[model samples]
Target: MPDPIRDADPTIAAAVESERERQESTLGMIASENHVSEAVLTAQGTALTNKYAEGYPGARYYGGCEHVDEVERTAIERAKSLWGADHVNVQPHSGTQANMGVYFAALEPGETILSLDLTHGGHLSHGHHVNFSGQLYEVEQYEVDPKTGYIDYDALAERARAVDPAMIVSGSSAYPREFDWERIGEIADAVDAFHLADIAHITGLVAAGVHSSPAEHADFVTGSTHKTIRSGRGGIIMCDEAYADDVDSAVFPGSQGGPLMHNVAGKAVGFGEALEPAFEEYASRTVENASALAAVLRDRGLSLVSGGTDKHLVLVDLRESHPDLTGDDAEAALSDVGIVLNKNTVPGETRSPFVTSGIRIGTSALTTRGFGPEEIETVAHHIADVLDAPDDDATLERVSESVDDLCESFPVYG
Candidate 1:
């Protein structure tokens, strides 16, 4: 190998190298992010990227897709095995695109859609006004119960009845607790609405059986391949065999063009890795680390949404604990010390989305880097220290030093 990138394009090569260093140096606590294995990285950087696989396996519009077909078929079969769905489509570009495929296949234009409100831990693609789903569909929203920080199923059912929506979306980006998918499905059935569970953030947990599978409860399930699964950057849709063709068509001709065969190959590789027994341990440890982090933060007087976490992440509502400190402030303060996470809006948010009342932290990436509860506890202490004394130079310096040591101990790419 001649190292084509470094030889041909030093600028892009430097940027890529710098990004690798950044990931290797910082702790990735963002709920939606993960560091894929080298196998996945290598798979995604293969010659398949040059192929134009415009359609599904064995039936493509273009030529030269036999190997890519095998890759995609492997991905689909592994996905079906992992999620226990009757049908699976591995072509959607991202979780949002997968949702779009489902909506396009199931709903007419201007039909009503009921989903969780954005400030209440829902995604923008779920029904935010700026998203195409909101612009094309009549949108209604549900919220978390303010006192408990959980979805009020009764209220959601009542609202579903009132709205008479065409589809009801269940799933969230930042919710700390598991969903009652059966209850949501029953509500959708009562309202004659299709149920779409976008389990983008919890895909791996569900796959590993740590979280309940929505495959049996919801009409359609959508997830991102990258998030908790570490299956490269892409999306997937699962449904009954009846809607498979519709979903395939919607994903291909309706929403996107040629599929990314390189990513599909990556998905195949990652899915195989997840099929191993070690992956179950990874998923379990991820949740355990999050719980440990949550306990440490709570002991430090930080208020958590839903009181705690059942999955790989925790949502910290800083309103009561640090009235003057915005989530943005904590995020920036922590980032300055190389602790990376994102600001998020809590239920009944009082500030703009840009300046939220909360921060969302996850253990999936750190878990991928072989972190356990003790390491996560130390990271939690570093987080709390940064947030506790954002303006104190000495404290920041001390936390930065600790973060550097932690990153050195658990090298992300190693």
Candidate 2:
């Protein structure tokens, strides 16, 4: 039988097929990406996509939303169970939107927000000048300790006290170490500021108890459902029950209109999967694989942020070890060899963000592909080799072939 997509639009079908092949053939090392389970993929493609459940589950604006209401409710309840939050909102379109909702619910425009500096492993949504968070609110940034490549909590608290921000964001995109959520919460409390912990990059780890959770420490917790969680795509927001109405209204009327029901369905399936014992094993191994990768890179003389990782990713600073090599060049070299990651600005960065001095590698997708510590060690060696001799054709060829073999051996899809 002819494929339905191909029959309707050959161009899109071709691109989709190519993308699938690409994902199957290469290593997805992006710290923010993961391969969702088949059940999630199927759920996201269901008839729920046709619904417009503009409001929360039992109180939708639309009439024909009974089924979608169930889906969204299931997603919310499952997320609450996974994170142990007092209230959960599974309707945010993305992590940024989730943040926006929180901000709208809790702060006024022109209010101050203190968060980690972007060049120091922070996310754009955390208050970068280019994002709404910065343009709308007064933003003050803190940085990591230059010598240790870890958040300088002392400095952060000092700055927070000085700025007296309305909200203090505690989470990172490129930080390899776990955050001191309790300490950050205390800092926020000292200033009578709300704490928004954006755990977009480590949602799965926190859910599986592999990393420290901020749900208990922060006033609000936000995360991407797709990252380590392996939910197809979407974001989640959690807050205490006291703030539930404000958060829900902010999400529905303040930030976005109707929720993306299909993605909500995907979140439901993924959250259900995470509740399983096997998902706990997967999350644990993801961190273990990351540690294995870090060990190999350090052994090869690569300078890692924080000197190692306590989560699913490693941030490699190239400035000290390979002063001449830019992160863009290394990223391109690794991509050529079928290892897909991203160029990231490291702590104490001297170069532009586009041409950074560091690269971020992750093991969530590799772990999802069934690659263990031994496999991760091998992949890490290949990465180091490629970075060491990026211009050598022989080296690139050898690493590319090995990457292909590894991808085949550990297929992303069964």
Candidate 3:
């Protein structure tokens, strides 16, 4: 093959090599990102990418899909076993597309969709005015309790009743605490609305039984395969058998065209890895590391959403502790020292999304790289030190050195 990528286009090859080096050198704390396993990488890089597997397993719109059909079937079976869903569709191109499939299948244009406010941790696809979900549907938003930094089910129920929404969306991008799926299900039942739980951030945790599954409660469940799942990069939808055909049709003809069979193979590989006992430990330690990080930050006077984390990420509200330091400031300072994460908007955000008042840190990638609570605690201290004196060169140098040492010890790709 003469190393096609390197021999043909050295430009892109260099960029890919540079990205690999970047991942190896820095700490990745982005809540929605993870390092997929080598098996997944190999699978995604296979010849499956050349296949155009349009439509479902047996009934495809394209020819020469037998092997792709097997790969996708394996993915769907693994997903069903992992989430206990009656039907699974591993076809949507991304989580946003998966949400679109559900909406297109179930709701009419201009029907009401009530979801968490974007500034309060909800995703843009849930109904941000700029997204198609918002433009096509009547959107209403709910917020976390300002005092407690948790979803207010009472207020949510009240809103559902007052609005009489057609669907209620649950799940978040930055929330730290676990959702009460059962209660949310009851609320949806009370209002006669469909409950669509987008467990994009917590997919692996739910699969590992570390978090509660929405499969039994929500009418439609959507997730990104890459986030906590360590899959290549794609989306999935799960629902009862009654809605299976509609979901499949919506995903194929309505939202997306050919399914990415290479990614589907990647998902199959990753889902198989998750079925092992070690993945359960990885999921558990991910949560434990987040808890340790939360404690370290809170002890240093930074306010954490919900006081602590019960999942893989922690949301730090920097308003009270560092009045002048915005989330953008913290993100840049941390990035300077090779700790990569994101600036996020906190509940009751006073600043714009671009210059928000909080930072969201995650542990799944670190945990995947063999980091435990002790190493994560050390990382947390480095974060606190950097934030304490962001402008100090001496402090930045010290933390930078520490990050280098940690990266050497963990060795993300070794």
Q: What is the TM-score of each candidate against the true structure?
A: 0.99, 0.99, 0.99
Give a tens-digit lDDT track for model 3, residues 137-244: 999988999999999999999999999999999999988889999999999999999999999999999999999998888999999999998986989999999999
Residue 54 error, candidate 1, Å: 1.2
| Candidate-wise lDDT, in order | 0.94, 0.93, 0.94
Clashing pairs in 2: none
Question: How far out, in Å, is residue 317 in model 2?
Answer: 0.6
lDDT of 3: 0.94
TM-score, predicted candidate 1 vs. hidden true structure:
0.99
lDDT of 2 by residue, 140-205 (tens): 999999899888888889999999999999998999999999999999999999999999999999
Please report the TM-score between candidate 3 and the true structure: 0.99
- Record all residue pairs in model 1 with backbone atoms less than 3 Å apart, i.e. clashing: none
Runs of candidate 2 exceeding 4 Å displacement: none
Candidate 1 residue-wise lDDT at 240 = 99
Q: Once model 1 is optimally superposed onto the true structure by TM-score, how far is the C-alpha of residue 229 displaced, in angstroms? A: 0.5
Cα lDDT for residue 354, candidate 2: 93
